[model samples]
Target: MSSPLPLVFDAPKRGLPPRHLADLTLAERTEAVAALGEKPFRAKQLSRHYFARLNVDPAQMTDIPAAARERLATELMPQLLTEVRSVECDDGATRKTLWRAHDGTLLESVLMRYPDRATLCISSQAGCGMACPFCATGQGGLQRNLSTAEIVDQVRSAAAVMRDGVLPGPDGKPAPGRLSNVVFMGMGEPLANYKRVVAAVRRITDPTPSGLGISQRSVTVSTVGLAPAIRKLADEGLQVRLAVSLHTPDDELRDTLVPVNNRWSIDEVLQAAKYYIDRTSRRVSIEYALIRDVNDQPWRADLLAKRLREHLGYLVHVNVIPLNPTPGSKWDASPKDVEREFVRRVNEGGVTCTVRDTRGQEIAAACGQLAAEN
Candidate 1:
């Protein structure tokens, strides 16, 4: 049979059900509550539960009227996700959750508690369409883009876990009772789901009575260098960090590594990255996954550093990641010595560089692995 047609990038879309508070903007939330025959002030109280306190339980909303709590919760806070399974590793500091949505779609997100902070890696789509050959999620193909509420719910749940003292750090503390950072480098190409992703960012950064109060600076939105989208985000004037997953420096090899590079050349991607740096005054992060004998050469390292110097200037930082190999894939991480050499060359060229810590490998918590099994 012929392959089925793919999802059109620009087709008019209907979002996920409104049970999720994250899908609604502040004004929308006000209107929804007002529609429920409640006063406008109820919207502010609901916002506090969803954002500031990070709790959605009607029983805990003491400030709200006892008679009105059940009605409000039923109308505003229907559960969107059911936990499928949770895998814990790193001596219990890291936990990856596989969730089944209300529609029975499987998706994954991770919560990691560190000494200083807790971070959550959230997915933007049910599966990915990017089709990067080395990636497991790419092989599965796209299921659909997640709604804004689906994406934000991941953070809300993780934040609630941290606050409840369920996740502990090395010192056995409750990891500060708040989520410190959020990374968008999970399953999908976030920029591909542009409107929802941007909406999610606003929900995450807005102060209480509107959305979650997380600092915009603490959020990192990653993409595989969607050039036009990169430029568009720069115009947003928000301070959230931007990460460009430039797996390889040269277009000749990257064309195979990241197929999207075929449409937008490396030069165009870097130039767009420069615009982000100039506009936001925030350092752009370059994520390079080190694979054995491929894109791991010292020469490629030097070229990567040189390119950053030319296009990004001082507003760039390199995060070299050890490739987390799929079960039967031909690829594996580069040798430690080679990995160190790659870092050395990039630093010598006068750009900041470091190897990213590889975590949750045993449970397939690394990027591109979760969606593979689902």
Candidate 2:
């Protein structure tokens, strides 16, 4: 049978902005600045203001000559995202922002603050082309891949919000904290936009004056079992966590749920994941969304555990996500009892499993829900 999945990476580029500082390396930035008739050191100043201090306003960059600030900002710091609206929930600990790109494309990024760490879930593309029937984003199909700067800007914006005490804490007070974690679980299959996503990761984990300086361990890049891409990422020599959205263990069920499974079988994906673990020495995360009466059968869970144990052997953890049913969709989350049993069976087979904490349901925080509604 012909594959149902849409090839997303080659999608047409529309409204992608001109080159910005975030898209360039330090040397490249220096060259870009000099092209504007400024000294090489000006690039470092701009990087400090944007990446290190999270400030982008040209008016506040007093260190640079006033005449050059506007020119540099206009060229290097072009505004990429404009907030359309922001909604908060979970006692003000979770905030989701709807951003309008230059081309009027709508994308979303969620900032969720927990007791121990704050995590930002950012989108890698405007819409997804994986065609996973259950996913709101996937259902809409791919719009275009986000540029490297656009991806990095989301993290920088969230980190600024955390540092500036913009979002309220669980105690209902403006509690400033660090943005410690980032997950590429928002809209597109991250690995589909492989080059930009990899560039974004480097811009996120590199230390001050170069990038965001967040530890690689704190960043998680999720994919829907793109086996070759998984192996390619393993060789990047970074410690960032890898999450596979393997909703089912059996090729039969997975082929229907995750359309990409038709191309890369479950065993092939798992073997690639094993290669990742062997190379990175970091535990892989298996994300399984439990749909009612679908892939949530206890026996499937047992098979999931068995397959994982045979391949990963304690080097993996299963994050069982209760289905966030789309509006008017037939799919529904598995019952609590069924969910519990699924977890139980996975553990019984010698693999760790837990139900993930579902957040921002009220604000359409699950993937492309907000953009779809808008």
Q: Which candidate achieves the best lDDT against the true structure?
A: 2
Q: Local error of candidate 2 at 70, Å?
A: 0.8
Residue-wise lDDT of candidate 1 within 255-303, one digit each (tens)?
8898788778899999999999989899999999999999999999999
In candidate 2, stretches whose alpha carbon ends up further than 4 angstroms from where it belongs are 1-9
Model 1 Cα shift for residue 313 (angstroms): 0.6
Worst 10 residues of 1 by lDDT: 1-10
Model 1 segments beyond 4 Å from truth? 1-15, 173-176
Query: 1-374 in candidate 2: lDDT tens per residue?
Result: 45644455565667687788999998899999999999999999999999999998999999999999999999999999899999999988999999998888889999999888999999999999898999999889999889999999999999999999887766778988999999999989899899999999999999989999999999999999999999999999999999999999898889889988988999999999999999999999999999999999988999999999999889899999988989988999999999999999998999999999999888888899999989
The per-prediction tally of clashing pairs is: 0, 0
* lDDT of residue 361 for candidate 2: 89
